[model samples]
Target chain A: MVKVVFTDHAGSEQSVEVATGVSIMEAAVSNGISGIDADCGGSCSCATCHVYVDKAWLGKLDAMNPDEDAMLGLSTDRQDNSRLSCQIRLRDELDGIAVTTPEFQF
Target chain B: MSDSIVNEEIDRRPESKWSMVGKDPYSMPLEKIDLAHPGIWQENEFLPFLKRLREEAPVHYCAESATGPYWSVTKYKDIMEVDTSPHIYSSEPTIGIVDAYEQFTIPSFISMDPPKHDEQRRVVQGVVAPTNLKALEGLIRQRAQTILDGLPIGEEFDWVERVSIELTTQMLATLFDFPFEDRHKLTYWSDVATAIPGGGIIDNNEQRWAAMEDCLATFTRLWNERINAEPGNDLISMLAHGEATKNMPPMEYLGNILLLIVGGNDTTRNSITGGVLALNQFPEEYDKLRSDHSLIPNMVSEIIRWQTPLAYMRRTAKVDTVLNGQQIKKGEKVIMWYASGNQDDEVIENPERMIVDRPNARQHLSFGFGLHRCMGNRLAEMQLRIVWEEIMQRFERIEVVGEPERIYSSFVKGYAKMNVVLHPKKAA
Candidate 1:
């Protein structure tokens, strides 16, 4: 299992563990984390699953695909480290990854 | 195009002779069912026909209709597949059931494919983005209060006119930085843009074209005024200075403007009216709401699902594709029935009931899915949320005193007239 920490807009953090193969979006959703809406059910279509990767762990995650980049562009809250959690799969190398959810999902 | 040319084109087009009105769903043959007809929709008799289609033929085809042959995708999952795979199911030329005539068609991002679609959508989407809505919330609440406070208690009034139309029109005007006094023209043009010819809003295509010309002229003046000014937060200013849109031709500019105006206007207006009607129909749910005001946010989503305003969006098949075991050929029209999918019992439990606190209400198909999903979704939600919050504070109940009249078009599902009486809260 890989560990993931989700920090909400209010600075509240919730930690959860899930199998390594599942996406970070699934881990957050299955663990009942408050911030991630994942409205498109992890298709990377809706930008609702957006999260800002912690700067320390940003390089550890896989690169953003064209679809993810396009979807994130529509968001007014997009930032330098912004990523759609659905596009990131949990892996042992990224076991202690931390990300923060935006206040609102566009 | 000149008025004489427009008249000639209108005269050449044939009128729709087929209608599904007064037809019994159970008695009709399976292949004979056509959901495109505005007859059953305006009468509020579309549910059974939609149910029949979802059960028997999830991806059914209609060979002969006013809009020509098209496939009806009623299941939620099937609709999702079609929506997400834009490469297979393209949104081009037009998204309406009826094919666009060369002279009448106005090119907009909604009907364009990717690269171009992405570029154009990115330019104006920020206007209604969540961050922008935060700024708009205060203004929206103040307007809602003014409109609601003006209502007469214990007296019958047309809620559709006084509240729904007025509130949404004001909101639209604010978005465009339009003159508040002439805001009613936005509502009229929106109605005209989506109006089905011979559907009471307009007698024929000529009238529809004439109204559109007037809309174009008005918006053109707004564009010219804003183009050289300092960049502002309003939508018109955004488009006037937008890199991808600034150099667009006159027809394209008018098309995009009409798209935003109609997109912002009718959908929410009907949902506003629909919420009152839905709560009246489901008094127990209304009781649930009165007891816990926290349910207001969730209730807003349920109301959107129940209304399913702007019932279906049309996509043309780009290639020979098989969806849900049904074959859709190249260049054929595929209509995703959001109204039916929202009520698909397989996905939503007790699909017909208006539960105030229904879980996963935001997952409904009302705003659609994939690339062309409604850009103004958050704005619409905020407007509904604020309206409900202010409403609970002031009125005990918004009672629907009479039968609500529905709109004529199958595309824009909403109320045309609804008599309502406000009941103020008894002092605690």
Candidate 2:
């Protein structure tokens, strides 16, 4: 199992043990973590699952794909560390990855 | 009579030749196929046509049809491109392919661009907020239990009328605080609101107006009553007292009312019916459900994706836009076929079959996306989740006994009649 921490807009953090190969967005949803609507079901569309990866762990995952990047660019709150959680698969190397969800996903 | 008028309109229109291709969809080139014709949907021949469009021509154009020329975005990625970029692809004027009759188009927030759309949407958004949804859960579960418990076992009955329509209409009545005895009128108005002339629900435009006038009159009375009362939680009261919506014009008020009614009624209702049909179609999935009830919520999303209650939403090009290398001219109708998008193999693996536990189930475009996404989506999902939970505890199977009589229109992809019989589990 890989552990990923999600800090919601309210500053509450939830660390969930997700099975390897599951996307972080799926982890947040199946764990019932709030603030990740994941409305488009983690497709590279619908930026509802946008999250800011912790600076230290950002380079651990593969580079963001163009589709995910375009969707993130649509968000007014995007940051350098911004990533769509749906695009990041949970792996053994990314056990301690952390990301913060934006206040609004619309 | 309505058929003759359609024939007359077709004969008079100089553009009718292009539309003739739609008459024989099977022989027409895949790229030229028009799924907008109500006949294609009514005859239940739309599935293969849509499949072909998704494969051969992801962004095909139909230059002629009952609703005129429009672009069909069939692939998941292409549909998302149009749906997300509201600025280029405007929902203004209307969302359906058919133009609203002259001086009759209602301007609801769903059809408005930002500033106005955001402001008006904020007014009633509270009705489906998380806090409100939490409060409504108990009531929805209780209602679902009552509705399910009332169904007769071992007897074929129309599930569309008894289960799907009844539960959704009940929810709508509570939302508006509408008269319970007259709650069926909500369903009636919803059907009439989206009905196509000679499409089996209404005969002509005149009858359509007559039905809508009845809807307007009925809701106007409720509006008047609620406008003066203390602010309440019901949808009518929300609009009546909302700062942005308190003084809407007659047509705008009617438009918003129809938006809420149809938005609330159809999606969830069809999913309820579709869920049973899908389970029956794939019994292993039903076995999966029976073995693990925890999959209910995910399965709910899967059902909505599989059914895609609303097939397509039309948007007009505010500016010329090139989507998937296809030039969409300004003012051209660009339709995002959610039904096709939901089945796009590129996005969803093995897109053909129902897998209740599909991991990315909620990724489907059934509730739409961006600012105009279905406002009552959470409410819709909550209702479905509760009903199915109650169903799992009660019955071994809700067998689909006969063919589902589908609705006539291409817009609302749903059932008109679905005969079902409940197979009750013997009391432990």
Point to the candidate with the largest lDDT.
1
DockQ of each: 0.70, 0.19
Model 1 in CAPRI terms: which quality? medium
What's the TM-score of chain A alone for every prediction?
0.97, 0.96
Residue-by-residue lDDT tens digits, candidate 1, A12-94: 99899899999999998888987788878888778899999999999887789887887887788899999999999988999
Best by DockQ: 1
TM-score of each: 0.96, 0.83
Candidate 1: chain B TM-score equals: 0.96
Per-residue error at B36 for model 2, in Å?
Answer: 0.4
Per-residue CA lDDT of model 2 for B105-170, tens digit only, reads 567888887768877888887787656777888898998999999999999999999889999999
Distance from true position, residue A1, model 1, in Å? 2.7
Q: What does the lDDT come to for candidate 2?
A: 0.82
Off by over 4 Å in 2: A1-35, A41-47, A50-106, B1-26, B102-104
